[model samples]
Target: MLPIFLKTLPFFAIIALGWFAARIRFFPPVATEWLTKFVFYFALSAMLFRFSAALDLTSLWDPAFVMAYLGGSLTVWLIGMAVARARGLSLPEMAMEAHCCVIGNTGFLGVPMLVVLLGPQAVGPVLMVLIVDLLVFSTLITLIISGSGRGPIGWRTVAPLLKGLVGNPMIISMAAGLVWAWLRLPLPDPLVEFLDLLGAAATPGALFAIGASLVARSASRIGPAIWLSFAKLTLHPLAVGIAAFGIFGVQPFAAGVMVAAAALPVAGNVYILAQHFNVAMQRVSTTILISTAASIVTIPFVIHWITGGLP
Candidate 1:
C-alpha cells in the first residue's frame, strides 16, 4: 500500500508544483501564451498523431466504448448545467461553468497518465476517451454556449465549431494516425525513434502549461470556484461510477479509466476560454487547482475501491 501510494505521489506533485510556479510567473507572460499555443496546436497535434498511430480503425469502430463514454459525459453535462442554472447563473456564465465541470483535462493529464499507469494496453480506451472529448463533449459545449441569434443555432457560432473540430490539432492528428494504422503502414526506424523523443515530452509540457495558466485568473471569485470544485471532485465521478457499473456493467480496466476520467480536475482549456472571453476566470482556476489537489487522494481510493483491489 505504501509503495503504491508513494509511486502515485509524483503525478500529483507535478501538477501541484507546476501550479505553484505559474502563480509566481516563472515563465514570462508573453512566452506563456506562445508556449500554450505551441502545446495546444503543435504538441497536442503530435501527441494525437502518436496516439492515433497506435491503434487500428477497427478499434475505433467499437460502439460500446463510444456509447459508454458519451453516456457518462452527457449525464454529467446535463447535471452540471442544471446546477449552474439553479444557482441563477446567466446564460454565458452557466455555459462556461458547465463546460468547466464536464470536460476533464484529458489531453494534458489523462493521456500521459493512462499511458504510464495502464501501459500500451491503455491506447484503445484512451483513444476512445479522446474521440468522445472532441466529437461529443466539446461539440456539446459549443452547441450549448452558442446562443440562437434571431433563430436557432446561429451560423456565426456554428462556424467556430466546424473550424475547431475540423481544424483541431488532435483530431487531425488522430485522423492521420488512423489512416496510417488502417493501412498498417510502417515508419522507418529513424522516424519511430524520433517520435519517441517527441512523445516523451507530452505530459510534463502539458502539466507545466496548465500550471502556468492556473494562477493569474479571476482571483476574486473564489466562492463559486470552490463550489464547482466540490462538484467536480465529488459529484462527477459518482455520476460516472454509477452509470459505468450500474448501467453498462463496465468492469476492470475500462471501469478504472472511466472513473479516473470522472475524477479529473477541470480542464485547462475552459480556463483559457474563460480568460479569453473575460468570463469567470478566478473561479474556474480555483476549481482546477482545488479539484486537482483533491483528486490525488480520491483517484487512488476510487481506483482501488472500484477495481475491487488496487489495479
Candidate 2:
C-alpha cells in the first residue's frame, strides 16, 4: 500500500503544486483557464487520439464492461438523487448532485494516471468508462435540467446537448482515432513524433490545471460536499466493483480498471455544468475540492486492493 501510495504521490503533488501556485497568485485564474484550454484542445486530445489509434476496436468495445459500469454508475446516481430529494433540493439541484456522484475525472485524471499505473491495457476500459459518463450520464443530466421548467422536451432543448457532444474535443479525438484504426491507417513517422511530443504534456499539464482550478473553489458547503465526496470516492467504486465482478462478470483486469476509474474524484466538468446551469454551484465546487484531496489517499488504496500490490 505504501509503495502504491508513493507511486501515486507525484501526480497529486503536481496538482497540489498547481493549487499552491494559484493560491499564492503566482498562477492567476486566467492563466489556469488558458492552461485548461490547452490541455483540453491540444495536449490531452493528442494523447487520447494516439492511444485510441493504437487500440483494436474490438478490444475497446465490450458490452459486458459497458453494462457493468453503467449499471453501477446509474445505481449511485439514483442513490444521490434520493438523498438530495430527501434533503429537499430542487430538481436541477438534485440532478447536479447526482451528476457529482457518478462523473469521475476520467479524461484529464483517469486516462493519464490509470494508463501509467495499470499499463496500456487500462486504456480501453478507461475510455469505455469515459464514454459512458460523457455520453449516457452527461446527456441524462442535460435532458433533466433542460426539460425541467422549460416545458416539453423538443429539438430546441436537445440540440445543444447534441452540439456539445459533437463538438467535444475528447469525443472527436477518440472517434477520429477509432476511424483511423478501423481503416488500419499507418501514422507517418513525423506525425507520430509530433503526437508523442505534444501528448507528453498532458499528464503534468492536466494535473496542474486541476490543482489551479481548485483555488477558485471555496469549501463553503461543507456538509453536502462531504456527502457527495463520500458517494464519489467510496460508494461509486463499491457499486461498480459489485456490478463488474459479481453481476456482469466483466474480465478481471478490465473490471479492475473500471473500479479504479469509478474511484476518481468528482470531475472538474461537473462543476462546469453546475456553474453553467446555476444550480448547486457551491456544493459541486466544494465536492470537487474535497473529493480530489481525499482521492490522494483513497485512490492508492483502491489501486492496491485491485492490483494486489503487484506493481
Candidate 3:
C-alpha cells in the first residue's frame, strides 16, 4: 500500500499544484476552461484513437465485462436513488444524485492513470466502462429528467440525447479507431507520431485542469456531499468488485482495472448535468470536490489491494 501510494503521490501533487495555482490567481478560470477543451477535444481524443486503433475488437470486447460493470454500476445507482428518495428529493434530483454515485471521472482521470498504472491491456476494460457510463447511464438520466418534467418523452428529448452521443469526440475517436483496426489499416508513420505527440499532453493537462476547476467548488452541503463521496469512493468500487469477481467472474486483470476505474471520483460532467438542469448544483459540486480529495487516498489503497502488492 505504501509503495502504491508513493507511486500515486506525484499525480495528486500535480493536482494540488493546479489548485494552488488557481487559488493564487496564476491559472485563471478562463485558462482552465480552454485547457479542458484542448484536452477533451484534442489530446485525450488522440490518445483514445491511437490506443483503439492498435487493438482488434475481439480483444477489446467482452460481454461478461460489460455485464459485470453495468450490473455493479446499476446497483450503486439504485442505492443512490433510494437514499435520495428517502431524503425527499424530487425525481430529477434523485436522478442527479444517482448520477453522482456511479459516473466516475473515467474519461479524464481513469483512462490515462489506469493505463499507465495497469498497462496497455487496461485500455479495453476502461473504455468499456466509459462506454457503459456514457451510453447507458447518461442516457437513462436524461430520459428520467426529461420525462419527470413538462410532458411525455418526445422527440425533443431523444433528439438531443442522440445528437450528444453522436457529437461526442471521445466516442467518435474511439469508433473511428476501432473501424481502422477492423479494416486492418496501418497508421502512417507521420500520423502515429502526431498522435503520440498530442496524446502525451493528455495526462498532465487533464490532471491540472481537474485541480484548477476544483478551485471554484466549495464544500457546501457537507452531509449530502460526504454521502455522495462515500458512495463514489467506497460503495461504487465495492459493488463493482463483487460483480466483476464474484458474480460475473471477469478475468482477473480486466476485473481489477474495472474496479480501479469504479473507484474514481465523481465525474466533473455530473456537475455539468446538475448545473444544466438547475438541480442540486451545489451538492454535485461539493461531491466532486470531496470525492476527488478522498480518492487520492482511496485509489492507492484499491490499487494496492487489486495488484496484491505486485507492482
TM-score-superior candidate, 1 or 3: 3
Best by lDDT: 2
Regarding lDDT, does 1 or 3 come out ahead?
A: 3
- Where model 2 places Cα greater than 4 Å from the true spot, the runs are 309-311
lDDT of 3 by residue, 1-311 (tens): 78889988888888899899999999999999999999999999999999989986877888889999999999999999999999999999999999999999999999999998888988899999998999999999999997796788999989989998999999999999889999999999999999999999999999999999999999899999999999999999999999999999999989999999999999999988888878899999999999999999899999998889334
Query: Candidate 1 or 2, higher TM-score?
Result: 2
What digit string (tens of lDDT, one per residue) describes model 2 on residues 1-311?
A: 89999999999999999999999999999999999999999999999999989899977799999999999999999999999999998999999999999999999999999999999989899999998998999999999998998899999989999999999999999999989999999999999999999999999999999999999999898999999999999999999999999999998999999999999999999988988888998999999999999999899999999889233
| Best-first order by TM-score | 2, 3, 1
Q: Superposing all C-alpha atoms, what RMSD in Å does each candidate have to the true structure?
A: 2.4, 1.1, 1.1
Candidate 1 colliding pairs: 218-282
Q: Roughly what TM-score does model 3 have, to 2 decimal places?
A: 0.98
TM-scores of all predicted structures: 0.89, 0.98, 0.98
Global Cα lDDT for candidate 2: 0.95
Of 2 and 3, the candidate ranking higher by lDDT: 2
C-alpha RMSD in Å of predicted model 3 compared with the true structure:
1.1
TM-score, candidate 1, is: 0.89
**lDDT for residue 300 in candidate 2, whole number 0-100:** 99
State in Å the error of residue 4, model 2. Answer: 0.3
